[model samples]
Target: MEGDLGWWAVPLAVLGGAIRVSTPILFVSLGETLTERSGRINLGLEGTLVFGAMAGYATAVMTGNPWAGVLVAALAGAVFGLVHGLICSMAKVNDIAIGIAMMLLGTGLAFYFGKPFIQPAAPDLPSIPFGWWSDVPQVQAALNVNVLFLAGIAAALVLHWGLRATKPGLILRVVGDSTDAARAMGLRPAVIRTMATALGGAFAGVGGAYLSLFYPGSWNEGISSGQGLMAVALVIFARWQPLNCFWAALLFGGAGALGPALQSVGVTQGYYLFYAAPYVLTLGVLIATSSPNRALAGAPGELSITK
Candidate 1:
C-alpha cells in the first residue's frame, strides 16, 4: 500500500491537503466573523456557499473565464445575504429562522438552475507552483498552492488590522455591542447589519468559487459537504477574531486531511475513524469551551447567542 507514497511523503501530503482544504473554511469563517461582529449570525451561508459554487461553475463554463465566475458567485451570495438582512431587520423576524429559509431557498435555486452545468466542464482557477525546486513529484504536487489560498491569508491579515484600527470597524463594533447606543448616536443598526451581512456573503461566495473553480474544480450538488455550516462553529472557536479564524480553519483542515494522509502512507487501519477526526475535533472544542453561565469571552454583546 505504501509503494506509491513513501512514508516520508505522509507529512507532506497532510500539510498540502491541509492548505488546500482549509482555503474554503478560511474564507467562510472570515465572512462569518464579520457578520457576527455585527451581532448577527447567518446560518444560511451553507446554502449561499452551494449556490455560489453552482453559479461560479456555470459562469465559468459559459464565459470561459474563471475569474468572472468568481465575481458572479460573489454577487449571488451578496443577493442572498441582502435578502436575509432585509428580512431579519423586520420587527418580529427571527434571524435564525430566516437564515434557514434562505438556505433552503438558495440551495433549491442552485439545484434547479445548475442542472444543465453539472455535466459540462468549467474553467479552473490558476495556482502558484512553489515546489519547483523540489525533485520529488509528490513534493511538486503538494506545493501547487491555489491563488485563493494566498488571498485568504492576506484577507485575514487585512481584516484583523481593519477591525482593530479603522473607523468603520469601530462603528460596526459599537452597533454590535448595543442597538440602543447606535440609535442614540443616530446610526441605523439595521442598515449597518444589512451591509455587513452582504459583505460577509460576498466573502463566502468567493470561498465557494474556490471550491468549484480550483480544488475539486467541479459543479455538483454534494460539493459543500457541510463546510458552510462548519464555519459557524469555527467562528465560535476563533472567538470572533479574524486571525484566530485563520488558524482555526487550518486546524480543521488538518483534521480533515488526517484520513487521506494516513491512507497515503499505507496506514489504512481504522480509516473511517480518521475521516471523523474533523467532526470529533469540533465537538471536543465546543464541549471543552462551552459555559452556560456566561457568554463566550470576546463575543459581541448584542449577538443573539449572548443574550
Candidate 2:
C-alpha cells in the first residue's frame, strides 16, 4: 500500500478519493437542489437512484455503450420524477408521503428486475488522464478523473448561473417561494414544479449511471448504499444552492474517502469508524440545522420541510 507513499500520498489519495467518491453525490444533490428550488423534494430519489443504476448497467451490458446506459438511466429517472410530480400535484396528496412511496416502489421494482444483472459485467465509463504530467503511479491514478465528475462541476456552475440570471430560473424561484405569486404571474405552478422535479430525477439517475458504469462498474442491489438518501442532507447543507451542493459533496466525499485513505496508509484498524464519518457529519449537520432557535437562512418561503 506504499504506506501512503511514505506519508505523502495520504493527502493525494484523499483528494483523489474525494473527487471520485463525490461524483454520485454531486449529481444527486444537484438533482435535489432543482427539485427543492421548485418547492418540492423527492425523498424517493434513493429509489430513482437505485433503479437508474440497474437500468444503466443493464443498458450498458446490452448495448455495449456506457453513454447509452447513462442516457437511459436519465430517462428512467425522469419517468420516476414525472410520476411523483403528477401524483403529488393532485388534491390532498402529500408530497413527502408520495415521495416515500415512490422510493419504495422504485426499490422494489429494481430488486425484482435487477436480479439477473447482478453477475454481469458492463462497460465502464472512461476517465481523463488529468495526471498525465505526473510520473508517479499513485499520482497518475489519483489524477485520472472521470468525465462525469467534470460534467458535474460544469452542471453546478450552470445551475448556479441559471438560477440567478435566467427567466426559467426566475419562474422556479417564484414557484418555490410563492405558488400564489407564480399563479398571479400567469405561470402554472404545477407544471413548473413537475418539470423541475423531472429534471432533478434525471440528474439523480445520471448519478446512478456513474455508480454502475464508472466507479463500481457493475449492477447490484446494494450499489446505492444510501448515498441517495444522504443527498438530502447534502442539499440541505448546501442551503439549496447548486454551487454549494458541489462544495458540500466534496466535503462529504472527503469524509467518505477518509477510511480508505487511512487503509491505504496501512492504518487498517478502525477503518469502519472512519467509513462512518459521512453519516456522522450528516447527523451533525441535521442536528445543527434542525435547531428551533435559528431560522435556516436563504430557505425558500414555501418550502415545507422548514415549516
Candidate 3:
C-alpha cells in the first residue's frame, strides 16, 4: 500500500503542476489555434504576450483596476494583430516573417514603455476562492488555482464547439481549407483571416495580462521566460483544435513546473533539463503529429504551411 501510494503521488503532483502552469499556455495556444484555423499564423504571439503584459500592468497601475489592464492589453494585442494582418494580407510578406518582425517590435516597445513602471508595485488581481472548501494544505494549495487557468479551459471547449458546430466556425474552416472555395461561397478569405488573427491576439494579450497581474505580481525585464513562443508549437501539437490545446497546454505546463517542484524536494542538479521539459515535449508532440506525406492528420487543407 505504501509503495502504491508513492506511485500515485507523482501523478497527483503532476496534476497540481498542470493547474498552476496551464493558464499562459492555454491562452497562447488557443489564440494560435484560432489564427491557424483561418489559414493565418501569427508567430509574433510571444512578443504580443510580453508587450501586453507590460501594457496591462501599466494600465492597471494607472487606473487601479486590473480588469482595465486586461482590456487595454486586448486592444494592444488587436493592434499588433491588425498590423500582422495588413502586412500579410496586402503584400507578399510571409506570415512567419511578419510574425517574427512583429515579435521584435512588440518586445522593443514593451521594454521602452516598461522602464517607468519597473519599480512601482501595481495592484494585483484577486484569485477565485476554491480553497475555501479544503482543509488539507495540499488540497487547498491545488484548489487555490488561478481563475485564468479554468477560464482558459472553458474558452477552449467553447471555441472548439463554436468552430465545429456553429455557422461562423464552418465559414472560418472553409476559408482555411480553400481560398477558392471561400470565394465560391462569397466569403472573403482575407477578412476572415484578419478577424481570426485579431481575436487570437486578444486572447494572447489577456494571457499575458494574467502573467503580470496574477502569477508574478509586478514586472521586470525577465518576467516572461518564452511561454509565449513555445505556445506556438503547442497549437501544432494540439492539432489546431482549441479543446486539444487545453490538454496539451496543461501537459506542457506540468512539465514546466516539474523543475521548481523537484528543487523544492532537494533535487537541483537537473534543473536546466527539467526546465526544458515543456519544449522537448512540444517538439516530440509536433514530430508525432506532423508528416512528410499527406496533409497533417487533422490540419486544415488550404493552410500553406501544412500543405
Candidate 4:
C-alpha cells in the first residue's frame, strides 16, 4: 500500500495541477485564436491580462461580487482590444509595433491604477467540488474544479463549430485570407478585424480574472507570470485550431505543474528547471513548426508575420 501510494500521488497531483493551471491558458489561447483567424495579431494580450487581473480584483473588492468582477475585466479587455484594433486599422501603422505599445501602456496603467487595491481581499470565483467522492485529501483538493475551466471547454467547442459552419465565421476567414477579396465582397476588413480583436480581448480578460479571482486568488503585480505572452505561442503551436488550443493548453499546464508535482512527492532537485519546462516546450514547438519558405499550414494569409 505504501509503495502504491508513492507511485500514484505525483501523477494525480499533476493531473489536478494541469486542470488548475491550464484554465488561464485555455482562455487566452482561445481569444488569440479568434483574433488571429481574423488576420490580426495582438501581442498586447499580456498587458490586457494584467490589466484585467487588476480591474477584476479591484471590482470584486468593491462590489463584493466575483461575477461582477469578471464582467468588468471583460469590459476592460475589450477596451484595450478596441484601441489596438483602431490603431492598426489606420494606414501606414504597423500592427505588431502597435500591439507592443499597447502592451506597455496597458501594463503601465494597470500598475499605476492598481496600486491601491493590492492588499484588499476580494471574493473568489466558485469551484465545483468534483473530488467529493475521493477519500484521499490530495485527490479531493486536486478535483476542485473551477467553473471557468468548464466554460472554456464549452467555448472551445462552440468556437470550433462556429468557425467551421457559421456565416460570421466565413466572413472572418474571408477577411483573414485576403483583404482584397473582402473588399471585393463589400466586406470592410477593418471593421471585422476590430470587432474580432475586441471580442478576443474580452476572452483574455476573463482568463485574467480566473488568475486573480480564483487560482492565485490575489491581486498583485506578479500575478500574470507571462501566461498572456505564452498564449500567443500556444495559439501558433495549436496551428490556429480552437480544439487544438485546448489540448495544447493542457500540455502546457502539465509542463507547468512539473516542479510542484515533483515536490509533492519529495523530488525537488532542479526545481527551477521544471518550472521552465513550459517555455522550453514552447520554443521547441515554434522551432519545429516554423517554416522559412511559407506561412504555417492553416495560418491566415493576411497576417503580418506570414506576409
Candidate 5:
C-alpha cells in the first residue's frame, strides 16, 4: 500500500539491489579466490563468465528449465578453466597473458554462437520473497532475494571452512605456498593447480548463469560488464578469504546499485556518475591498499602480485 517511506526507501532499495547485483560478483570472486589460493590466476574467467551466460541462456531457452541451463553453464566453464590451467602449467608461461587471450576467445565464441538466442526468451531462476511480510511494495520488491545469492553466501562459508579444515585444502595451500615444498611432499603442483583452476572456473560459470537466469536476466554479450575481470581486485580486497569475498561482493553490489536506487527516488542529477560507483570504489580501494614496501598480508606466496 504505502511504499512511500520517503528517504528511507533509498537505503532499503539499495540493500535489495545490493543483494541482487552482488550474486554474480560474489560467485566470480569466490571462484577466483580459489584459483588464486591454488597458486594460479585466470584472467580468462571474464570470458568463462560470458560463455557461461550464453550457454546457460541457450540451454534454458531450449529445455524450459532454468536449472538445466545453470548446470550446462558450470560444465562449460570447467572446460574453459581446464584449458587455461593446462596452458599456464607450461614452463615460462605467463598466466596473465594467457588469461587475456582466453578472455578474447571466450567472448568471440559467445558472440558468434549467441546470435541465434539473442531474441529468444528463457525461463528465469526463481527468487525468495523475503519481504513477503511487508505491506510496502518497495520493501517487498527489495526483499525478493534470489536463491543463488543465498547459495553464494553458503558457498562462501563452506569455502572458508574447507580451506582451513580440509585435507585437500592443506595440500592446495602447500602447493600454493611453494612448488619446491609440494614436490618434496610428493605432490604434483601442476596437476593440483590445474584442478583448482578448473573448479574455480565452474564457480565462475554459475555466476554467469545467475546473470542470464536471474537479475538483468537475459542472454547478452555485454552481460558481464567486466565483473569477471574485477574478480582479481575483489579477491585481493578480500585478502583471499572466502567469507570476506561475500562481504566484498555486497559492497560492490551496493555501489553498483546507487544509480538505480537514486533514480527510483527521482534523483537523476548524477545518474551516470552513480553507475560508475563500483569502478571508483574499486580504484580507490586498490590505490589505498597498495604499498611499495610490503606485500599483501595473506596473498599466496607463489602468486605474482605477492612477488
Candidate 6:
C-alpha cells in the first residue's frame, strides 16, 4: 500500500503543478494557434501580452472594476494586432522584422505607460473554491483550480470542434493550407488573415490581463517573464490545434513549476538551471517535431515558414 500510494503521488503533484503553471501559456498558446491556423505568424504576441497586462492593471486600478480592465486590455490588444496585420499585408515590410519591432514597441509602451500606476492598488479576480471536497491537504491543493484554467480548456475544446466541424473553420483551414486554393474558391486570404491576427491579439491580451489583474496584481515593468514568446513555440508544438495547445500548455507549465517545486523542498542548488527547463523542453520539442527532411506534419502549407 505504501509503494502504491507513493507511485500515485508524483503524477498527482505533477497534475496540480501543470494546472497552476499552464494558465498563462494556455492563453498565449490558444491565441497563437488561431493566428497560425490562418497561415500567418504573429511574433508580436509577446508585445501584445505585455502591453495588455499594463493596460488591464492600470484600468482596473483607475476604475475599481476588474471587468473594465479586461475590456480595455482587449481593445488595446486588438489595435496592436490590427497594426501588425496591416503592415504585413501591405507588402512593404517583412513579417518577422515587423514582429521584432512590435515587441520592442510594446515593451517600451508598457514601461512608459506603466510608470504612473506603479503604486496604485487594483481589484483582482477571485479564484473558485474546491478545497471543501477533500480532507487531505494534498488532495485539496491539487483540486483547487483556477476558473480561467477551466475556461481555457473549454475554449480549446470548442475551438477544436469548430475547426474540424464548422464551415467557417473549413474556410480558414483552406486559406491556411493553400492561398491559391482559397482564392480559387473566392475567399479573400488577406481579409481572413487580418481577422485571425486581430482575434489572436485579443486572446493574447486576455492572457496578459490575467497576469496583471489576478496572479500578481499591481503593475511593474517586469510583470511578464517571456511567457508570451514561448507561447509562439508552443503553438508550433501543438500543431495549431487548440486541444493540443491545452495539453502543450500544461506540459510547459509543469516544466516551469519544476524549479519552484525543487526550491520548496530545500533543493535550490540549480535554481536557474531548473528555471530553464521550460525553454529546454520547448527547444527539444521544436527540434523533435521540426525536421528539414520531412515537412511538419499537418502544418498549414500556405504558411510562410512552412514553405
Worst 10 residues of 6 by lDDT: 1-10
Candidate 1 Cα lDDT to native: 0.90
Per-candidate TM equals: 0.97, 0.97, 0.92, 0.97, 0.98, 0.92
In candidate 3, residue 48 scores what lDDT? Answer: 92
What is the lDDT for 240 in model 3?
83
Q: Runs in model 1 with CA error above 4 Å?
A: 1-5, 292-295
RMSD of each: 1.3, 1.2, 2.8, 1.6, 1.3, 3.0
Clashing pairs in 2: none
Model 4 lDDT-worst window of ten: 1-10
lDDT of 2 by residue, 93-143 (tens): 888899899999999999999999999889999999999997788999989
Which pairs clash in the backbone of model 1?
none
lDDT score, residue 253, model 2? 91
lDDT of each: 0.90, 0.91, 0.83, 0.92, 0.91, 0.83
Worst 10 residues of 3 by lDDT: 1-10
Considering TM-score, which of the candidate structures 1 and 6 is the better prediction for this target?
Answer: 1
Candidate 5 Cα misplacement greater than 4 A, ranges: 1-3
Clashes of each: 0, 0, 0, 0, 0, 0
Residue 176 lDDT, candidate 5, scale 0-100: 86
Per-residue lDDT over 1-307 for candidate 5, one digit per residue giving the tens place of the 0 to 100 score: 1247867878987999899899999999999988998898889999999999999999999999999999999999999999999999999999899999999999999999999999999999998999889788888999998999999999999998999999998998998889899999999999999999999999999999999999899988789999998777999989899999999999999999988888887888977899999999988887787787543878888986666
TM-score of 1: 0.97
Global fold similarity of model 4 (TM-score): 0.97
